[model samples]
Target: MKYTEEHEWIREEDGLYVVGITEHASEQLGDVVFVELPEEGSEVVKDEDICVIESVKAASDILAPLDGEIVEVNSAIVDDPGKINEDPLGDAWFFKLKVTDLSPMDDYMDEAAYKKFIG
Candidate 1:
């Protein structure tokens, strides 16, 4: 998994990139109540806000970690937002992107660095 400072995580899977908030982010937000996902086919730039996640405390933007075209969205989390807190890295994933630039990943952190960063 590659992690951005904004707390988004991206992992390559079957040639597509899966994206979601880190568990640390979900914990910080308390409990997720809503998620607004970007539409499929939208173009996004690295570090730009592509979606929004709302919790009881506040709403946070989910940024794009790499430039890409949104190819799929995880509607399950939109319907049951609390799934974000329950399984932040798995069932609660927000979207998948068809990557356009691999260069931006050079700025992301590995799991260990991300853990340390949050700590």
Candidate 2:
């Protein structure tokens, strides 16, 4: 898993990536109430806003940390947005992307670095 400065996280498997907000973000958001994910097959670039996560506190944009095409969205979260607070990095993943290139991943932080960054 890798993390973006904006508090999003990405984990890759078999060339596809699962993307979501980090736990720190969920805690900050204070109970997600809604999620607006990008349509599948839509192309996105790094740092672009691809989704919206609204909580009681504020509505936050979930940015793409790498260039890719969205291939799947987590419908489960759309139906029950609180899943993000329960498991932000796991079952609550917002979408999957078919990465256009792997090089940009190097710019993201690993777990330890991310922890420090949030601190």
Q: What is the Cα-based lDDT of residue 24 in candidate 2?
A: 94
User: Measured by TM-score, how close is model 2 to the native structure?
Assistant: 0.96
Question: lDDT per model, in order?
Answer: 0.92, 0.91
Which residue window of length 10 is worst by lDDT in model 2? 59-68
- Mind giving the per-residue lDDT tens digits that candidate 2 earns over 1-119? 99889998989878799898899999989989999999999999988988998999888888888888999999999999999999998999999999888798898899999999988
Which RMSD values do the candidates have, in order?
A: 0.8, 0.8
Residue-level lDDT tens digits of model 1 in 6-49: 88899999999999988888999999898999999999998788
The C-alpha TM-scores of every prediction are 0.97, 0.96
Off by over 4 Å in 1: none
